[model samples]
Target: MKKIFIITGEYSGDMHAGRVAEILKQKNPDIEIEGIGGENLKKARAKIYCDHSKMSGFGFSIKMALDHIALEKKVADYLLNSYKPDLVLLIDYGTFNLRVAKRLKGSGIKVFHYIPPQVWASRKWRIKGIKKYVDEVLCIFPFEIEMYQKEGINVHYCGHPLIKQLPEKADREQFFAKHGLDTTRPLVSIFPGSRTIELRFLANTFIKSAKQLQKKHPEIQFCISHAPNLSDDIFDKYINGTDFKVIKGENQALLSISDSLILASGTVALEAALYQIPMIIGYKGPWILYLAYLLVRCIKKVSLPNIITGEDIVPELIQAKFNTENICYETEKNLYNKEYRIGFIKALGMVKEKLSDKYSAEEVANEIIKAL
Candidate 1:
């Protein structure tokens, strides 16, 4: 039997890894797969070496750094000594995965990186490290190929996974009725984000904005999306006194039915764009951390729809501008301005055309199978 080891460090990464595992298992039942992930990978039948909870976090902390360093050594030691897998797949959670790749360098084990770092977005210098460690780069964005080619790195432009993974628009009537929401009112959704740090920075601001927006537009029905990766207690603390319907486990469906959205900048922006939902992105953090980000960030825009189209299709409120007032104002435009909302939706539609139609996980699976 062939052996493969995979590593992922967050909910989205684990989900992506799970999709790849599902395809890999279908292709070759004899293949044995194991990984560091959560429920998604477990459902896909891969053995869990370690849960990604320990690996998930947003910023620098001494304890987090030490924990990850210890994890890297443990994972590398196991792969090199006991597991001795034929191929190792590294999903995102870029920093941790890169460190693992560096440790596994020159081990004669093929290391394939799917959904590699966004070097084009920031820290372009990391491509040097990618070149040194990873054997093949299965990058998601079309623009990433040139950078890799320039570096003389082996590369494949696998169409973005979201393109194929996103489900068809949910039945709005059914969704609204199921949630006890009135079909007569325009539904607006708020996605604070999946990370605890994000909830800390944006949740209250988002809730306050929703309250204000509701006061102004009494006809609008609002719901807050609770990212499933978050524990109930961790999420509840953020929503304590806020009284809107809290939607959990139906995020994509909620996105499909929403007339507008207030979101924290991340992959969810792209997911909303894919659904062609008009939204405004708001994200802020500690002043020091924001400054650090500004120093490294290569792109002027943060929302994925704008980044993919190279135009500001969605309004972004970063740092100083990410306030309750701005969020309400932008979200209001998305909800009430017919002409502006139409144009925004049009631009979002173009994003799908710019991406490849190939099934991303399937391609990754086929390539790995061929290599094995």
Candidate 2:
């Protein structure tokens, strides 16, 4: 059996890698695996060299520079000399993955990039880096394939991994009963983010917005879904005096019961769409990090739902737009207005159509088998 080394950066990447690898394994059970990942991939039986928590953060690479460099060199050297897999699969961990890609450029191991970096957004030059290193790039977005192809990279549009995870019409009663939530009252869910920096920037703002809503309508219930990467103390600190409950890592369940959501932009927004919940997406990167957004013109949209459907299905309040007042305003619109709810659900249905029914893991597994 040939060995395949899988590399992932954070929780979402780990989750994506785990699903893809599982599907690939099902298709070819004889292939052996090894590399860096987290709990999900570990459960999938990938021999993880390192867990992703040491490198999880938004913005500057300088924040985790020393540790990032250490891990990068460690993982890269390991793949190059230790396991020496037949193929090296790089998931989205822009800085480190690129470094690993560079080191393995001429090592004879076929470099397959599963989730390409956001070069279209900030580091277009990274395509130059990718072209020099990666042999085949599998992209989730159809647009990405064209972009990388334009840059002379062998790219494939594999479709997004999220489309396969769709649940049957959400069982609201069962969900509520399981979580012990009241169905009669309006449910509002808050997701600050999985990172500590995101919690610092948006947690207070979310709490303030929730408090304002609670003041006006005591009948409303505010629920927070804590990203497992972050601690419960983070949310507790901000919501100490307020009447709110934090549901650790139960983002999906919390969103299912929600009439509306206040969440950080990215994967969670996509999840919200699947649940058919009216949502307001918000994000805040440091000032210097925010400048990176302009440097990378490739990122057209921040919300996953919008990117997948090629249109804004829900309001994305990024950077300056991500404030207490803005969140409250959008929440009010989505919750009280009949038109907003109707329009959002209609857009969500279209997003669902754009995605493949076959699981992402299954599709990605097929790609790996064919590549080998």
Candidate 3:
């Protein structure tokens, strides 16, 4: 039986990796799969070597950094000497995965990277390491193919897996009734992100902003889309006494029924765009990290949807700019201004067109099998 090892660093990566694992199993039932991932991979029948929850959060402290390094080394050594997977599939988590790639460079094991890091956003210099270590790169974004190929790295543009995984739109009336939401009110969804650090930095601000907006537009109902990875207590602390509805693991339902979204600038922003929902992307982090980002970031836009279109379709407010005032201002513009909303939605249609239509999980799975 062929053995494949997968490694993912976070919740989103784990979800994408799990889909690929499921497809791979369908193609070759006898293949043995093991990985360092989360519940998603477990559901896909991949043996859990290491739960990726251990490596959560945005930036690691010194102790965390040291501990993760030790853990990664131990896992790498075990996989190399004992498990000896025929192919090592890496999904995002660039820093650790890049190191893993370098370690396995001449080990006679094929290394394939799915959803390669955002080298174009910042640290374009990492292209050297990627070119040297990664045998083949399966990219989800169309623009990423040119960037990787320009550097002479073997790469393929598989359509975004999210396109396939995107949930069907629920009946708005039934969804509202089921959630006990006021059907007459315009709904606004809020996505603060899945990571603990992200919620810690932005959840309170999001709540405060929503309250401000509510005072102005009393008929607008607010809903917070809670990530499954986070405990209810974390979100409860922010919206405890507020009127906002906390919707857990129902991003599609929430996005589908909402008029606009106030979201953290990441994959969720792109997901919101996919739904054709107008959104204001907001982000905040440790000041030092923010400063470092400003210094290193090569791109002007931070949101994936805006980056893909090469235009500011949705407004972005980061760091000091990501305050309650700015959030309300942007949300108000999207909600009340019919002309602006229509133009933004039209631009999003073009953004969707730029992404490939190939089923990413199947394409990636086929490539992995061929490599094996």
Candidate 4:
């Protein structure tokens, strides 16, 4: 029986890895699928080599640095020891996974990467590491193919997994009724992000933005998405001083029903785009990381919709620019201005056309199985 070991460093990666594992099992039930993942992977019936919560977070300290090294040694040693996998699949978590890729050098283990780093967006230097270590990249974004091919790295363009994986657009009326939100009011939802650090930088600003909007349009209702991965204590620490209903889980459903969104830059922005939900992206982090990003970022656009279209479809406010004033200004344009809102939603509609229609998980599974 063929065995594959998957490594993922965070919740989103875990979810994507879980989907691929589910399809891989269907394609070859006798094959072994084991990985470091969370609930999603466990549900897909992949063996839990480790839970990624320890691996997921923001910023880095000496302790964090040490923890990562220890975890890297643990995973690499485990893979080389008694549980040698036929193939090693690295899913996202570019920083950690790339380090693992380097450690696996000369080990004779074939490594295939799914949802590889967005070299087109930032830190193009990382592509050298990718080219050196990754045998093949199972990429999600259609445009990444050209970048990889130009650099002489083998890449396969699998349609973005979210296109197939996202739940159907929720019934707005039903969703509102279940949440006890008034259907008559325009709903604005804030997604500070899945990480505790994100809440630190963004939850207050998002709350303030919502308050600003509500002050002007008193009838507008509000909710905040608490990523299920985060503990309640972490969310409550940053989210207070507002009565906005905190909706835990059901992120897609909330996105579907929301009229406009205040988002922290991440895959959720892409998910909102898929639903044609209008949103503005705001993100702030440590000055050191921001400066590092500025030094290496290849593109001006941060949000996926804007990056994908090469146009400003969704407004991005990052670092110093990511303030309550900017978020409310951009969000209100999408909320109150009919022409701007319609135009924004139409631009989002075109993103799907720019992507591959191929079923991503099925294609990914077939590629991995074929290589095996």
The per-residue C-alpha lDDT of model 4 at residue 301 equals: 90
- Tell how far residue 266 is off in model 1, in angstroms: 1.0
Candidate 2 regions with alpha-carbon error over 4 angstroms: 57-63, 234-239
Clash count for each candidate, listed in order shown: 0, 4, 0, 0
CA lDDT of every candidate = 0.90, 0.79, 0.87, 0.89
The 10-residue segment of model 1 with minimum total lDDT is: 54-63
Model 4 TM-score, 2 decimals: 0.97
> Model 3 scores what on Cα lDDT?
0.87
Ranking by TM-score: 1, 4, 3, 2
Give me the runs in candidate 1 sitting further than 4 Å from their true place. 57-59
Q: What is the lDDT of candidate 1?
A: 0.90
- TM-score, cand. 3: 0.97
Task: Show model 4 residue runs off by greater than 4 Å.
Answer: none
Tens digit of per-residue lDDT, candidate 4, span 1-372: 999999988888888888888998887899898989998889998999989887885357888888888999889999988688889999988989998889888888889999998888898899999999999999988788888999999999988988888889899998988989999889999999998888888888889889988998899899999999989988898998888899998999999889999999999999999999999999999898899889999988998888887788888898888887888889889889999998889999988878777888788789898898
Question: The CA-based lDDT of model 2 is what?
Answer: 0.79
Error of 3 at 62 (Å): 1.0
- How many clashing pairs does model 2 include? 4
Which is the leading candidate under lDDT?
1
lDDT of 4 at 127: 98
Model 1 TM: 0.98
What TM-score, over all chains together, does every model reach?
Answer: 0.98, 0.92, 0.97, 0.97
